[model samples]
Target: MRVAMIGQKGLPAAYGGVERHVEELSTRLAKRGIEVTVYNRRWFSDYQKKTFQGIRVVTTPTLHTKHFDTITHTLTSTIHALITHHDIIHFHGVGPSLLSWIPRIFSPHTVVITTFHCIDRKHKKWGGFARIMLRLGEWSTCRFAHKIIAVSKTIAAYALAVYDCTAIYIPNGINPVKPITNSEQIIQNQFGLTHNNYVAVVTRLIPHKGIHHLITAFTGLNTKKKLVIVGGGHFTDLYVKRLHELTHGDKRIIFTGFQSGAALHALYEHAALVVQPSELEGLSISLLEAMNYGRPLLASDIDENREALSDYGWYFKSGNSADLARQLKKLLATPRITLERRAKIGQVYVNNLFNWDTITSDTLHLYEKLVAVKPGKKRRAVAAAFRLAK
Candidate 1:
């Protein structure tokens, strides 16, 4: 069956987890002989209609506004998809949900399936109108979708609690494991990393990410090691400028900005330990990626992270730099092999629970169920009647 995957950004997966999810899921689905098309914002002058790995990448006109980017993209994408008339339209994030009302009008034959990536209003990054937009978007999307996919049980519960809708809990997925070869030597030379020289935190540089807390905790640790921060954001330069002042040229804390492809894997492979200090998360793909590399994780104690890691990860009090520091020191004192063992356990947990193949197949099953209807049933007519009555 033909499927159109609409997202805030188009696929080559430059940054976020949702984009990565689309890239992996769509490509795998394509390999399985399912036709897939992904919609992306037209960012570069070089960008044009193209196919990347069997999935069609359709560029739609978008507004590069501070917060209205999604709304603009959704509007254009709605028009684009209606013209294409794809069999199923699977949307990622609540951004597109703002226009969820349009699917019934624009593409009636297409089934709308939405994946709730996170409870956006609760995000620390959102403010004022942005927060209000999120609430409205959530309500509209939840009401419109034939089926809603939640990334975790916690996320699913949040959706039901907020919207009172039936949502399927389908967590994010990662690819199979392949050991990193010469990862340590390569990263060491590239970033001037030394043996047990730092604690690594991989996350976008945002206030809610709790990076400041990690840095504060690391500074007070009485150790001579560095805190290697890997990630860049639109707000990155602002945060980095402030962070440099906070670190006071200590030179122990290094900000490596963003790394992708082989560089990302190499950093994860060689890090002494990986820390996820997010104030909020819905089953972080970063944590799962760390697990895939068999890296020990020190994550904030939150329901989502706890649910993902179970007892396999080391926990620190959320937003408490002191507690985090203590936890880090304790772990640093342990054998490297001990960390390795924890990582192995974490890997087992992810492989069993978070593989993309299982997730995609389960998602396809949900779609089949959603689209499936008895020949005699007049679902569209009934839906039309209800809409007219409303």
Candidate 2:
């Protein structure tokens, strides 16, 4: 089957959960002998290559602004996919799924799949107008697409409650990493970080991510452990500056901008505790990776985080700096051996649950099931699929 992926920024994922999700799924599907084509936005991609890991990468043009970039790219990508006659066109984000109607209207024969990766309208980065459009995008994704995949259980329940759409619950998967050891010098020399002495949180610097709250919480703690925030902005410059202001020129706070590869793994390896303080998430790749590395975790108690963590690690009240400070103090005071023991148990648990191969098989099962149906029977097929999934 020839499949096309839209909405993610590009391949060779440096950051972003959607990018990593697309890359993992596409590569696995390609290996299984399915022809996969991933459309990359020109503004976000620096990759000059035509392909990666057996999957085709097509760089499509976009408007390059924060508001217009995703929607514009999806429109052009849908058009190109229609012309090229792909068997399935899969749209990733709610923002880009705004254009799913183009494919549904123009070419009724093609199978259109949309993944509700997150509720993008709730993010603080977008303005009022953008949020309105994003809300519309959510509506578009739910009603226009033949199949909808929600990344978290809460998201699926949300679809049923709000849109009355029975979105199939498919959580994000994590690949096991060989945790980098004996890299104390590599981390210390680059970022003044020492092994098992610094608190780490890997997240994009944005308003909704709650980095400011983390900074406030970290400062209140009496521990000598440093705070390391790893990631860059998603068109939120002023918010990033505000994060710096919240630090108040504290030398203990380290901002490592957009790390990947061995360096990132090293950070995860050496962290005493990994925190995911985001106010909201569909399903966090960062949260899963921390578990993948078997780092003792401390996450905000958002329903999404609770859904993923589930007695796996420590939790604090979401967006409450005082409670976060208290949780950190308590966890920091605990013995290292105890923390490692719990983290290791959590690691084993997550490995058995969220395997990438299993996720790929489940996804392919749905794809083949839908693609087998007759073209004119889309409405009946879609209803049946939804019923079966629910």
Q: Which has the greatest lDDT?
A: 2
lDDT of 2: 0.89
Local accuracy of candidate 2 as per-residue lDDT tens digits, 221-272:
8889999999999888889899899898998999999999888989998999
Q: Where does candidate 2 have its weakest 10-residue lDDT segment?
A: 380-389
Candidate 1 lDDT by residue in tens digits, 1-390: 788888648767877878888888899889888888888887622456489899988888888865867788878887788788777788888877877666665556678888888877777767788989988878866787777888989988888887788789989888876766777777788898865567788888877788888988887777777789998765356776776777867778888887787778778877788999998887799988888878889999988899888888799999999999899999988898888887898888888899999988998787677667411234673476357436
What lDDT is obtained when candidate 1 is compared to the true structure?
0.80
Q: Rate the local accuracy (lDDT) of all candidates.
A: 0.80, 0.89
Q: How close is candidate 2 to the true structure, as a TM-score?
A: 0.95
Off by over 4 Å in 2: 179-182, 377-390
